[model samples]
Structure formats: C-alpha cells, structure tokens
Target: MDLLPLEVAKKVRRDSTLVKYTDGQFIQSRGDSKPGISIVRSGAANAGIIGMDGSVSMTTLLGPGQSFGEFTIFTELPRTHDVTAVGETEIYQMTATRFTRLYDNEPQLSRALLKTALMRSHILLEMLDAIRRLPIRERAARILQSMSHTAGNPNKLECRQSELAYTLGVSRISLNRGLKQLAELKLIELGYGEIRIPRPALLSDWVANHCNPAPLAS
Candidate 1:
C-alpha cells in the first residue's frame, strides 16, 4: 500500500507514541499478543519468518510511511510475522484502543486504513499470480519495478541479492543468473547490495511486452 496522506499521517503521529529500535531489534514477534499499529517513521522494517533451522525468510520490507500490525488488531489474533528493524529505526505506534477511537471519529483515518488493506490484498494477489505464472527473470523485474514504484525511487532498491532470492523462492545461483541477464540487457545496474533501475519505465514496458498476454480472437 502507498503511504498515508500527510494530514492523516500527522493525525496518527499526534496520537501515537514514537519508539526507536536499533538494527536487528524485533518490533513485533510472531504469535505476540500485542494489538497495535506501527508505522515506520524512519529507516525500515522487515517482516518475515525464521525457520526452525534459524534461516530468515523475509517476506516484506517496509520503509518510511509503511505501517504494520493492523491485521492483528482487526482479527484479534497474534502477530503473524516477526517484524524487525533494518537499521536504526523510528516508529509511531498506536494501540488498538486508541486506533479504534480515532477510527470511529475520523473519516479520513478510516478511509486510509481501508485503502491500505485493500491495496495490500491486491498486491498479495498479484504476487501470487506472478510466482505461479512468470519466469524468474520476469518475476524479478516485476518485483523491482513494484518496489521502485512504491518508494518513488526509480533508480535504486536497498535490497540484497540473497534477500531477493529468498523472496522469490529461488536459489542464490538462479537469482544471480536472472540478475545477470537483466544487467546484460542494461535494464538494471547491480551494486554491492542493491539493484538500480536507471529507467523504471523501460523495465515496466519490457515486462508488459513479454509477460502480458495477447488479445483473444473475437
């Protein structure tokens, strides 16, 4: 989902507590009973699972303006994934009680929350479809494009190759090969721990032409 509107975010910040976390600190853990929404005010957070073998499989990277923990509040369930700070991070946290109060009295807050939930659902469906139907190369391109769009930074993705491989459910070797192909195509420029798309539109157009289906016969 996109960032909340400035005024709405300001309202949320006004009612929320600002908390800081160092790198690798857990903001919320799986199965935790806390019911609160945490929005990244600075730095980033990673939501994912730690396997029994202690391997981390990151599912989502949440940057500034992105919020988490809403599902737990709505469903009255435990936190589903472990959310950890990526670096020195600041978060604005609002408890379920406070959020409910604001939600009841504020139309804009309700609309923003609903919009985030809907957008998240839509993105989840798209990710599932891409994983099922697209090749690794195309899948990588789409994901990079999505991240760039979300962050409004067409040139850089602050993500590692290993993280991308885990997200794609592919081996590091396979992901490397796919990335190499993209680099050869000059669609992306790879760096130490990031991927850069100099022209995100070109990558988007390329994915559309290759991955989109042709029109059916009349």
Candidate 2:
C-alpha cells in the first residue's frame, strides 16, 4: 500500500486506531491470521523471521509512513514473520474487516494497494540476494543505513550490541569484529553500546562498493 506522508497524519488520526509500542515490542507475531493493515504515523519497526534454532533473519525495516502486514491482509494467511518495534512507535491500524470492505468495494484502491505490495516484494527479493552475497560488514552497514531515519541521533544508533549480535545470527565477537572493521575504515564510529555513521552517504557508498559495483556497459 502507498504510505501516507507524515503530513497526512491528520487524515489517518481520526479514523484509525492510535496505538503505541515500545522498543522491541512485538507488533505482530508469526502465525497470526488476524494481521490488520497498519499505517505508520511515526517511528520505526522491523519484520523478520526467527529460525527454529533461534537465529533471526531480518527481512526489512519499516519506517514512518511505511507499512507492514499487507500480505497477510490480502491472502488471509498466517503471518510469515514477526514485526517488532525498533523504537518508541505510533501507528494507525485498519482492522481486517474494514480493510476487506475497502478491497471489495473499491477496485481502484485495491489495485493501487496491490501494486505497492508487488513492488515491496520485488525489493525484498533483491535484499535477500544481497544478504546471500554480501559479507557481514556490508550487511551491518546496510542495517545502519536503514535505521538512519529513525535514529534520534542521526549519527548514532540506539541499539544494544548484544541484541544486534543475536539478530544478525553472529557471535558477539564476530559482530564486534565487523563493526570494528567499519570503524577502522572510518565509515562508522563506535561507542560503548551504540554505533554511529557520521556520514550516511559514505556508509551507503561503502555497501555499494563492497557488494554492488556498477557494471560496465559496452
């Protein structure tokens, strides 16, 4: 679905249920068939899968105005992943029944939402490909880049090293090493429990250079 710009908060605030979630709260759990469409008014969250062995494979970050749960809404299927609030978040939710009515009664709206969903699917596929081909450091940089919008301090990320280690499915030592490598390159700044990217463009450039150099065309 097309995300409403932050300016349209007034439009959504009236009809949608206003809900708040604290950092690390589960907004939706896997296997729940009742996921309603959520329109993010502010803050950020993440959607990811948890492996049987307890490893996490992050799918994507959802920021302000972005959305999650569209697939479940359209298919009536169990959710494939868990959505967790990355920070203090506020969202407006449209229940399954209301969304279903909109889908059935408004063909144009349905088509528009479907188009957005398809585009998101394509982006997720590309990200999965990147995760498969990229090194740990590149993956780390990508995550930091995604978090830039929600981070209170644009340069410093407000996430615990241990939690990130678990989410990335790497040993704390390994994650630290990856962070150290980026820090050494001056792409990121390391703090006690936070990581900083003084220049986000440089960080994005680091990932692009490491993982996706431009191809030469004849």
TM-score of each: 0.89, 0.74
Q: Give Cα-based local distance difference scores for all models.
A: 0.81, 0.70
Q: What is the per-residue lDDT of model 2 for residues 111-201, given as tens digits with 9 covering 90 to 100?
A: 5566667866665554565557767887677667655643434676656676676765678898889899999999999887567788888
Candidate 1 structure quality by residue, lDDT tens digits, 9-32:
677888999999998899999999
**Candidate 2 global CA lDDT score:** 0.70
- Using lDDT, give the best candidate's number: 1
Alpha-carbon error at 51 in model 1, in Å? 1.0
Top TM-score hit: 1
Off by over 4 Å in 2: 1-11, 50-56, 101-119, 146-157, 162-169, 191-194, 213-218
TM-score of 1: 0.89
